[model samples]
Target chain A: MGNVGNVWAVVAIALVAVATFSLGYRGSRHASTTQDFLVARRTVRSRRNAAAVSGEYLSAASFLGVAGLVLKDGVDALWYPIGFTAGYLALMLFVAAPLRRSGAYTLPDFVEARLSSRPLRRVSTAFVLVIGVLYLVPQMQGAGLTLGMVLHTPGWVGALLVAVIVVVNVFGGGMRAITVVQAFQYWLKLFAISTPVFVMCAVFIGSGGTHGGESRGLAEPLPPTFSAPTSIDVTTPVTLRVVEPVWLSAEGRVDGGSARGPVFWGPGTHEVDADTKLMFPGGAPVPSVAGTPSTNAEWLTPTGGGTSDLWTTYSLIFALFLGTMGLPHVLVRFYTNRDGKSARRTTLHVLLLLGLFYLFPMIMGLLSRLYVPELLVTGKTDAAVLALPGKFLSGTLGEILGAVTAAGAFAAFLSTSSGLLVSVAGVLSTDILKGRVRDFRYAAALAGAVPVVIAVFVRPNDISMSIGMTFAVAASTFCPVLVLGIWWRKLTPAGAGVGMTTGGLCVLGALVATTVSGYTGNWAPWYLQQPALITVPIAFFTMILVSKATQRSVPADVNRFRLRMHAPDPLGFIRDRDVARFGTAEERARLAEGRHRR
Target chain B: MTTTEQKPDWEEVQASPDFVLLRRRLRRFVFPMAGLFLVWYLLYVLLADYAPGFMSTRLFGNINIGLVFGLLQFVSTFVITMLYVRHANKNLDPVAEKIRNEVESRGEEK
Candidate 1:
């Protein structure tokens, strides 16, 4: 029965892959020009474009990672999803229309357009590469984990397979194709998550239910070990040194504690708490436990801390809310739309789609707490979602559920990686390689290869942590650039160039410090992991101060550019007559033929 | 091609009824609502930070103030979105339509 179920799971994954490739190939037909390849000729519907945005945004981090975190950590993990979805709201309010209006293909393009500086563009391009590669690592890692769980293959093999597929898809069709695949994947993910949850709920309710009934011994006080201080920042790698294995009951209370509760361990619990000091792997000391028993089990539980862990919690929230605006993949999707209004509408759809999808993962996390508490002890918390089907139902139903999850996991990886590749390709072609398509394709392959190598070698401590690191880098650098460039018209090229370089360097420096310092008792542990609390404000202030100092350096065309951005384009804004003046023979012929036909 | 034509200031352009109504509505309601929510979210964060005891205070069986605050962050997002959509539909949409008509007519004349 397990074999049959596994075969079905494999088949389902194969079907999804084939469908995705065909869709991408079909999209390539429409992507003959660089513009079409980059932004789908800027004519995509707002609704579909929004779906693609949300779809790409919902990575392994959202689907499997958050659920796993919730299963391991408890209610505190809910913040991850909330922060992620709220990012779209921020994007809607601040970024959507202005970004579309800028008429730039990539973030670097926006930098150049806003500051009119090639040097600034180069700096932003470099940041994009770093941020893109950072983001790509988690997606690759998640792909490996998901494939390993679903197909019983080695994790590295799964990672390589996903990297190859993503590279091909992005190389073949570019942004246009990725948009279609992402939109489709969004719905696929929604169904994948929702169906099993609905089935599990029904099955649980039908079989002499465990609903709303507090089981006896489930009210024990959490042990000191369970309540020990762990590094909360998602961006920095957490090194959990288990001096001893701390066993807890399903209720997350210490197993041998006088106050008995439901014991949680193995695959079900959201977080694993061993008698270990959680720090970065290199030996930096994270926050240590103050030996306080949490008042609320839901809050005080290590994985399920109530909002008391301020730095970790707020840093995460800040990352999610502000991070969306800076994400290259999500931003590039907006450029695919027809105009500013379309971009706005697309953002609205993304909000709804993402909000709906978040509900299931939260529920899954909560359910895992109740059912699969054993998995926590194994420290294989990521498998919480994949393990759900077998725990709830057996035989054919279990296999089907497993297959659906596997497919969804792969979808999460493929959609996100493709989006990242497109963004990377855009920066390479437009900024670095000077609009050369062939060179851009080579860059795309290189981009995919770099992350795959990183994934294979580094093998990040956790998926959520890897994603958070990417967000810190993004929030520190691109977030400041986009925000300042939009609101402050006085922004000079030198100022922007300086600000971006500073912000990017600060984030990179922090990342390096955190990585090299490891779990040792180093000051870098606290500061470097959550650098945004410092670097973001610094970037903002620097940009403003620099722009003020260099106000006169602003070009004469600044006003004209602002007017063009804010005002609606006039009818025949780009007339054939205008192009004819600068036209090659082929363009002139096309214009003359169009005029004669009209 | 009249590059020398004096461009009207935003204030003068906004003196039209359509713009006036939008400006009033945005100031009186939408802006205030957004401000209030932003404050609430910030307060929640501050409390979670400085007043961990307060955040840790339990409300129901195993439910703490921090959990409620975190959940409220989710609720507030939906609330703001719904409020925005309602405002756009009831107040902003008509004004926007009028502006669109004016802009379209002006474009046609050009």
Candidate 2:
């Protein structure tokens, strides 16, 4: 809220961008060949690759959105970070090592190699672009939200700024650039996010603020009480469900009446017009948005009273648990490993890094409910983490801490957006532009530009929920293709193509239906809200049954490719063809024999 | 073609006892491990969704059954990772490297 702090945050963000560019440029010095641009020549060490993976994975959804969800919804929302981190576990178990052994630079490359079909590659490419762009929009919108909060600028300004920075970084070095920059960002983000929490925690203790055991004002049987006199500024029109009558001072219209003085809101849903300032005296139960849980008990439970919580919870779990393997950006990073063994190792480290970083957001989320209760009314709960330090810690220190969080949030947007752009660009250049570096630059521009423009126009209310829907789409489509394609040697190209199309269309249709219906209660089937539950099984069944029915269409060399994918490098069953490209004739012969198994 | 050339057919190599053994070892570990983990995870998810009161059964001041179960997911992942790595190193890697040496030496001689 301080102009000086906002100016400092802007300056810090610019410095981080410049630093990222320099780091990327340095990494790009090794990027003379396409291999360098594509998979960093598969030279990054496991630990560094793990850090980069963690950096890219902890996007706007994890950084700010998780905390906001927790603050607003209570413990039920903690499942998000858990599912997000654990998805890598599912990845490690099923996809990670084998995918690296597949020796493909991109998802489409893997699809083409495995299925041995150009048309299948084209289909895979379309899905890659869809998932990448869908994932990218949320990061851009999150950047806009952060800028709007920190600097009081138009949201598009920050979104455009992030897009330009990502495009520049990718244009400079592609995957090589993103690797070093992202690894560095992981530490920078960890430091930026955790420091304020630690400082504020100490400050909280020093000020005799006991941790935990405090009543959650909303969860109690009675209505939530404000710990102190609070002023809530309604930025958007809201219908507040009041439990107890409270006399509050209002400057704008309340329930269609322009009130300049004290007005009483009875026990019912009251429409508070936009731009209204409602001041509630201390100990009065805080009114909440209609249909959301207004008590602490409701907030803690899974069936906490919105859209059939059972269906929503299971659907979300199915999507996230299976979806991580399908995220193109995440899958692309695994290719940076030198071998299957390292890829497995890197994923193990990612699990640890993600677990550690998530703890801070959980703490911050709980802190928000205690310190920033007014966020519930403003519906800007996404800003909970950014606003917490300022709410609790006063003076110069608090402003600087807020700036730190702002910088971390910007880092989140930059690292994730850059990773998504690079993956998308990789697909575009390799599939459409013949894997040329110059083409990659053009692809980067197209990849980054589309999302930024959409983010400017179409604003999703909850950042994490939008990301969840993207996960649902990804889970339905790629998860089946990758899992069955890797494990089930019976899978045919037609089966994969049909299954993917079916899953993708079903999820897309559900998404459009849900959007068109406009969040009305029970308008769409609950499965439509979380389509993975229905679509994932459909994908698997379609692939299995069709592949069974068309066994004659199976590739003749399925067993050879299967050996190449499953066998470790020590078995010499799989080799990096890129490395063999520059080798002598005999060396190339060895690599070919390794693959062809002469 | 060299008289001593010994280029084995991919079909033979795949059906060879060594390859079969390798595939079996991998399947023996991955299938059961993946199944157990998935079941454990989904059970927690089901309980969280359907049995809210049970999940909310507090253990400590505010720490509840659900929180513990959620935290266990992270712990189980790390544990499984360690077990799989150890399993690969102990059971899978030696035979795999032996097969590689046999194939490469025979190919070079040819």
Candidate 3:
């Protein structure tokens, strides 16, 4: 409805990109060596590292998709943001310090170093690629959506632009550059998202917040109504389920097919084609994207005494809570901290920062349910954040706020993909390819290219739900391996290899089965779709049992490895082979005796 | 060969009184704190999913039990971080740093 915002959005986005590359180039200028490119010795202070982590972690999912989910899915959607922030808590408690102490830069390196198996390293690298690609797809798609909305170029333009910028930046500075850009993006994203909510809330409060211009509560049993006469533009063909028939005029393809003239719709399902615009009167009950709850009662309550939501909810909780530690980028960021103590503290600060950030999305989501109820018509709730500001403010100020959200959403795509590509490149260069400078650039190029292709071809799902699936896979696979490797000494390389494959394969198979079967119903045994409840335990059990069976295959240095990992960093008991030649005669003698016995 | 001569007696250190005490104290904090938080979180999740009526009961200003439960998850995380940091600073860090210094000094007596 508001075309005035596009200019502001374009300017804001250009500013973000310029800042990203300028800051990115500064790091690349200093990073000549592969070591510096991949894991720079720049041990950022805890506060800054925490900010960068927050920046990288807050992708399209948190900025745009969370509120969208709120508009479409109702109160059940709040769990995602809560679980996302809480995932860091679990990470801090179980994995953060020990993982940082392990001193292996990437997941594959950590697995290979911990288990002493090259094959296991290969397995880890494969999973890294899968999770990396799975995670990146949504980022690219969201970029495409935001750019398409702002620039009116094809959606692929945004995805390609993000990919190209990320690849170029990675080739220039790699990990070192990414950390600075992400930290900057984190603050920018917070400002872009929060300022609109604050402005909207003042408007709502000043105008005496209520329903139907009366004092009706937010949770009252009524369908959301338009605050004003609204027009919904369907960019993709959407089958909207209208509850109460209203006089609506469409300018493009309606059920009658093509009509440059206006067409009317009745109180039933109707197919509106791409590029169609429908104008409705003020106070009309908003039509919903087919299959979404339209009333406040249905929306506010999560489930209707069903076992399906029960299964999905628990599995979702499991995935989101346990999955953060498994993300390669999240763990890699921990290495930027000076030591385990700082790593723990950095994670703690991330919790505080993330908690503050997640609160705004809830407000934005609630605001959208009232002001932008037409978003439910097209099922593109992801655009809810972008549309709400323009709806509320409706002038230069509205356009500016809309631009702020657009810039933030764009920043989300750039910072996350950049951070993710570094992890992908790190794995590819160090493990899959040679750890050469040239290979690192190739890895970065490959990393950016594949995700963009996928993003271009595939229709974007709800950004956060796709992310939730990726988290489920990560939880089923690496969460087990990392937790077991850190706490349980009996975890053999064979067990890890088998267990990770088992967990990863279950999720992959389930993802395929559900997708192929096209099972959308809540009762469709989504066990195979979101398998954390069943698969995580199975993953842990398989590892322990397999490790027990393969007891003889355990590393000879396993005990000393525990000592190195658990002992403070100041102790020279580090896992690095290079940190030798300083042993006392007594220590040297004991080492020789142990070797002789072996 | 000097290749095998560099490592200290790790099993011996792992068995030492100080290292044992450090590991014990760390595990003592780690296991229970992790378990407590996870259970609290899971209970909240279960109530949200299964007991919807109870969770949706209005408390104040449109704030329901479910909403409060969700927010409490954030609050609990805050408390956990502060408590863990304080506990580690008071209990675990000095011990770990002390052991690191001890091991390094032992090696320095070449």
Pick the DockQ winner.
3
- Number of the top candidate by TM-score? 2
Give the least accurate 10-residue stretch of model 1 chain A, judged by summed lDDT.
Answer: A280-289
- Residue A299, model 2: Cα distance from true site in angstroms: 2.5
Residue B31's lDDT within candidate 3 is 78
What local lDDT score does residue A25 receive in model 1, on the 0 to 100 scale?
Answer: 96
Q: Score the docking of each candidate (DockQ).
A: 0.21, 0.40, 0.48
Q: Output the lDDT of residue A414, model 2.
A: 96
Could you list the chain B TM-scores for each candidate? 0.67, 0.86, 0.84
Of candidate 3 chain B, the 10-residue stretch with the lowest lDDT total is: B1-10
| CA lDDT, candidate 1, residue A511 | 77
lDDT of 2 by residue, A1-598 (tens): 3222676677778878888999999988877777788788788999999999999999999999999998787777877887898788778878888788877777887787788888999999999999999899989999988888888889898899999999998988989889999999999899888999999888777866743333243345565566667788787888888877888899998888898999988898898898999998876677787766666666655543334676677678778988999999999899889887888889889988998999899889878877777778777788888888877676778778888898899999999999999999988987788667788899999999999898998746678988888998888888998999888889999999999999999888988888767645348766677788888899888888888888888988787677777765744334564555434567666655444422
- Interface Cα RMSD of candidate 2: 4.8
Clashes of 2: 6
Instruction: Quote model 3's TM-score.
Output: 0.92
Candidate 3 chain A, poorest ten consecutive residues by summed lDDT: A575-584
Worst 10 residues of 2 chain A by lDDT: A210-219
Off by over 4 Å in 1: A1-5, A209-308, A434-436, A519-523, A569-598, B1-38, B48-68, B82-110
